[model samples]
Target chain A: MSRRTTLLTALGWLALAAALLGLAPALLSDFRLGLLAKYCCYAIAAVGIGLAWGRGGMLVLGQGLYFGLGGYAMAMHLKLTDAGPGQVPDFMVLYAGGEMPVWWEPFRSPVVTLLAILLLPVLVATVLGAAIFKRRVKGAYFAILSQALTAAFAILLIGQVKTTGGFNGLNNFQSFFGYSLYDPVNKRMLYFLAAGVLLASVALMAQLHRSRFGELLVATRDAEERVRFLGHDPANVKLVAYVLAAVLASVGGALFVPVVGIISPEDVGVGASIALVAGVALGGRASLFGPALGALLVGYAETSLSESFPGSWSYFQGGLFVVVVLLLPGGLAQALSALASVRHRVGGPPGGRRRRERPASDRTRPGPTTPQEVTA
Target chain B: MSVPGRDYLEVRGIRVEFDGFVAVDGVDLTLLQGQVHFLIGPNGAGKTTLVDALTGLVRATGLASYDNQNLLDRPSHAIVRLGIGRTFQTATVFEELTVLQNLDIAGGVHRRARSLLRRRRGVPERVHETLATIGLTEQADRPAGVLSHGQKQWLEIGMLLVQDARVMLLDEPVAGMSAEERRETGELLHRIGQERTIVVIEHDMDFVRDFADVVTVMSAGRVLAHGTVEEIRADPEVQRVYLGHTVEGVA
Candidate 1:
């Protein structure tokens, strides 16, 4: 497809999604609308995973650290506001007396809370990415390092009951900006905000993917040593992409707390992080729209299946991931490409012969020794 | 013989050892401005090790400088930024990216932050010019991984061209090319050598004879002979170590 046509098609899809979201209040019940809103948050998280894991090849299995940071930030402000001046939130009252934790004091202001949510993840990711990428660590080693961080973050949160509200997490938020969140209109407005943000994030990702920075990201992914030889620091390139992905995940988490009316340790843990990546992989990591579609699909399946099958929903989710992994290693996007290639092969004229093939020795040689190859 | 006016790169007593194994020991070499120099040796004779040291891929013990700046302490990326570029023995073109995208990224090394942030202009044109020079303009939009091996090698060279580096270090540039492709690559290197210093590591003596202005023969981690190809071919030590019994035919 031509670039112009492809962009126009994407714009049309965005417009259709926005129109549907604008009309959702009239069509669906409040509960279903809320579910869709939650899915938008998941879609936002999936987009971040796509950039970090799919394009940059970082395999960031600990996106939950950023997610929880954002969620907890937003949740703390909501709890403090709901408790009125000076009073402690109910969760804090039961968990650790009727006193607000010192760490939670800064989040008393909504502006400070929101800023913290966004800035904290970017700061953490920058430090983490710089440390890891500068060392030239990559592949499975990088994946494990990220996953370990998520586990550590979750454990720390669970241990700090006085400050973080611990396992129960700060919930029962009554109002947002003097508006009752329980009202159907305000709830729908929040859903619209999430959908808008999801669409805008996708558009931003598309722009980045087309730019020169995006090419460098992919080049680093494919061959960091070669990219270094070309006079571009691969660590800096990967760091930029990594930090962007973390910020996106944090935004998703912040929006998620307000839309779902709840935030908990269970939601931002190792399990949730893995699920986020599975959805992106199932959708097609390299494609622009795949992660959003895949996240929404997974979200819908979780909600609908639990309503019908209850205890078996997790099993179904596990099975679906297995099917995608076994049958479509490239995710759903590859199916389309496979079909196109098959059609071309069948439709080509008869008597078209394969070109002459070169000997094995004529192919390029192996890459230079990497850190891993050297140690091994 | 040393050139009267300029030296694009100079190496003095450079030695590279890995895990106590001397790969290239005390190897001194130099390439004058706009000259094509060749490094040739038998298996494990440290030709690639020398290229690695020059490009900053491997650390060396002694003085290695480019344009009078010490290269031993600089990172690989910094070396490239100092107007030195290299191609791997294996083609290092971004496999999933298009040929044009690869060249555009190559040009990005020298781009300012402001220019990099905006829609990249001038890169497409530079990519086109480089592709055309390498005779791969027709395959500009195709994924580089899908190109023929010789075409991929040329595309990599095109990348080095767009990078606008003053010195090019190629590791076996004609390793996998057909005879015609090798001749075309030889002619292309000759043209490039007119404007930039080129150091090529190769096993093909025929290509070396046709392309090299100066040939340095290495064996057992040291320079065995350094002279014109015919002059080196006639050297008794080079004949004994590198050419062996086959020197009579080439001589």
Candidate 2:
């Protein structure tokens, strides 16, 4: 890495730390802070989506499936614990007429719930990835398959009304590990925890992007046949990346439950998956910080818009997406770069010669190609 | 080091059919350890198809074995793990990756549980050595996409070297090369043949005549002749099928 890149990376992390831990709670209201906490969870999922869909060329539209699995797992444990040992949870009686489901028994223990949150999504992704990648089902076929999985997962969860809490979904949790979530201090603590986890996940992703495995993953995505001929199994490499992305999404979902205090089939359905993808696209999918920023901004916009114009928020969101897509194909990051260039042109050395040289060098720098073209 | 009674590659009446159109038909060939075997044929003569079948990129109907192991049922990656490396007719390198990184990926890593937890080690030196051998050491840091056509071919061969497979299958390794580059590549293949079995598919008759220990000529999805260049040159069927139809001064 160059000295300039090193310094920029360090400064970026420092800024992120300050924004999450130092600035968020001080500037926002309690409700807004809670919303930001929810955004952090979304940001986590977006990061995984960016890696799999953007860099690895997987087009994983079903990240919400993993997210839901993790959230429901944690929610089950929380509901069970809140209800105490012998008695059934209140939602069972209210929603399902007092019949406790057999499948929900495993999640009574915190350890089992946590493990399930991490492992279940990975296992599912492994099987799905192996099945699809081995057959060289890629491009539109892969995208459709993954989207179908998401739709199936959501429908399955919705159909399992008794066990999964159904369309209304799992909610009305009173406490999390005896911390009385109604307490503002506990809410703030959850916010901090979300921020901390988001930071760690970003750091981990950054490390992965720089590693040899990352290089191979991108290469496999770009030219599957070439990588295969080079003696590396493209399927296996894609599987690793897919599983990692799934696990990360699951973790994000697990944290999202406590932070947002509810989750539903609707939240993990096909529409939700598309929303996640849109955020990544709007933020610059290949960029390190793009997904996180995009997710947070989208989340914030959703909440504020719903409050300001409850019936028209979706239309506004749709319009915003269109404008962003039209104006910034490379996402907000590229827009920022363009803005910086304009500023430089306005303020820098007077003669147009130096300005002319800038764009020429920029053109020579090789803009990021699509994941498929990257290795071809 | 040729092992006693151990042929590097053994194909017995292998046939590959794509949707009932035979691409490689009943071809029998063997590559002994530490020898350069050349496959020379016209376009669509099943030279690439044969290489594809050997590397498990495409399935074959008949018995195909490598180093005494059954290769007909194995997956392409499993075939690679069983010590077979291959390159495509068109130059295929990781365009985004530097030349060194491309070699490193080709050099298989020890799988410790899942690949996510595994670390790639000791590949840099191997990559460097392969780069030096292929005369690409000065351009090791350059992206593979930007290399000259001849350089890209060398880089790919370097990738095959780093893979450390007992058998290397190269399809048209000197395609699109300048005359000088083709000569250099012929010499490089000669050097690599000492360490591993090399099966090269080429249309260039001069390159095959200069480098091949034995030439397997294919036409119409089958092996037409298998012998020394002079022996193949004297075959009437080969002359009628190939040399007889060729334009003058092409070779």
Candidate 3:
């Protein structure tokens, strides 16, 4: 990218960060702020999806597998910390009172819990993605496999009543890593944490988007056979994106536990996973900010629309998906770019800086990596 | 003819079967450097399947070795790393990427994963030279999908060139080219043919006769005749397989 474009992009991100991290606390209601924090967690995972599914062309239908891993890891530690030494968590005490399960013992250490949150999902995704990609199981077959695995994981969690709190999952944490959750200040800190993580993830994604690896990932998506003849292992390329997406989802899930104050099978099941993908498609999966913004839009819509109409939100979401896919295959981001270019043609000054080119998401040129590229 | 001790690709009894149908029966040929070797046969004579086996895109048995390394049974990607590349009958460049990106990716075989994540400093010297070689330097920034069909073919060939493929298997590269484009591609083959080995599967007899340094005729998955273009043109077996027709008549 030109130096000016790079500077403009960096400035755009800084302005967004100022709004999200510096100003949102003062602007939104506590309820809305908390909700935004939750949405930010989802955005983190969505950014990863953009890379893997959008750029790498791997339709990941079970990202909740990793999300659940991080959420449960955080929930376990919080629950254990809430219950003092040698004491069982309230849910376990109320249901199958005897001793803390052997597995729950490790989450007692904050370090261990954080480690588990980071490494466990990566471990699982590495194993699962390697197995799947190595076998060249892809497209709808891969999607079905991922979806089924998430379903089974949810079912397993529901069945483990004695250990995993069963269908109730894990909940009611009084503290988060020794910070009192009841305090408004700490809660706001948690929100800041989530927002900061989301922004950082976005910045990282922008770098990835313009990287040569990103170009290769798109190449692999378009022509896997041609990539092989180029002497590249397509599986490895895909695994990188898949595993990174898994890690991002895991981090999002970890933060989600504290922000939402709960972790359950319902939150990390096929429904949740597909909902995340829907948001990505709505925002433009191949775009750097599209996934994050799309996820936020979906989360916000679900909250507001579900409250107003109770049960109509699902139908509305379905309609939106169908319309966006059929009419705007590149999603809202592409439409935005299209609109900008049209405006430029009709009203822009002569010798305009912007070229009559396709959107950054579609082009592999050295343009701004952020969503601002639409305007740039 | 292959040099006695410097065979680039030596094949023996390479066969491919699907269920009970034999796609490619046991066949042997020696590909030598500095030559444009053409593989010509009737449809379903295993022209493509033979290339497929040699490139590890299909399951094949027997010895197909390059630089003493067996090409059979290795992964398709591993075969490419050993400096062998093949283009499909239809051009298969990454449509969404630019011409430069396509060649950059093809030439990036030697780059490690860590290095791939950084911004490309500039077009590598090799890619710049290849763009000029393929005459697509003007279209380097255009998305490959929007290129003309002939341009796409050149882009695919340019990709192999950037890949530094020592032995390239091209499947009907000029099948859909204009007369002028065909001539340019013929010159391209001869220009690069002096440094590498090339196996072109073509039905265009004029192209074959004009560019072939050697020709191997296949019939029913077997080598029916092997010699220079002139010798194969006069071979009686080739004549019979050509429906008792001449080379130009078959074309």
Query: Which candidate leads the pack in lDDT?
Result: 3
lDDT of the structure predicted as candidate 3: 0.87
Give candidate 2's error at residue A274 in angstroms: 1.5
Off by over 4 Å in 1: A8-12, A19-23, A339-376, B1-7, B117-125, B244-251
Q: Which stretches of candidate 2 lie over 4 Å from their true place?
A: A1-7, A320-329, A336-376, B1-7, B110-123, B248-250
Tell me the tens digit of each residue's lDDT in model 3 across A1-376.
Answer: 4478578668877986998887988899888999999999999999998888888888888999999999999998988888888777888877787666798999899999999988998899999999999999988788899999999999999999888988988988899878999888888999999999999999998888778888888778767877898998899999999999999999999999999998899999998998898899899988778899999999999999999999998798888877776676677877887787777767876665554443443454322234322111
Q: In candidate 3, what are the lDDT values of residues B1-251, reduced to their tens digit?
A: 33443347899999999998998889999888898999998888899999999998899998998877898979999999999989999999877677888888888898977898897778999999999999999999877878989899989889999999999999999998999999999999899888899999989999898889999999889999999988998888898988853354365
Question: Model 3 segments beyond 4 Å from truth?
Answer: A1-8, A348-376, B1-7, B244-251
TM-score of each: 0.91, 0.91, 0.93
DockQ, candidate 3, comes to 0.52
Global lDDT of each candidate: 0.80, 0.81, 0.87
What class would a CAPRI assessor give candidate 1's docking?
A: acceptable
Go through the candidates in order and give the clash count of each: 0, 0, 0
- Candidate 2 CAPRI category: acceptable
Query: What local lDDT does model 1 show for residue A329?
Result: 52
Q: Model 1, residue A325: displacement in angstroms?
A: 1.8
DockQ scores of the candidates: 0.43, 0.35, 0.52
TM-score of chain A of 2: 0.91
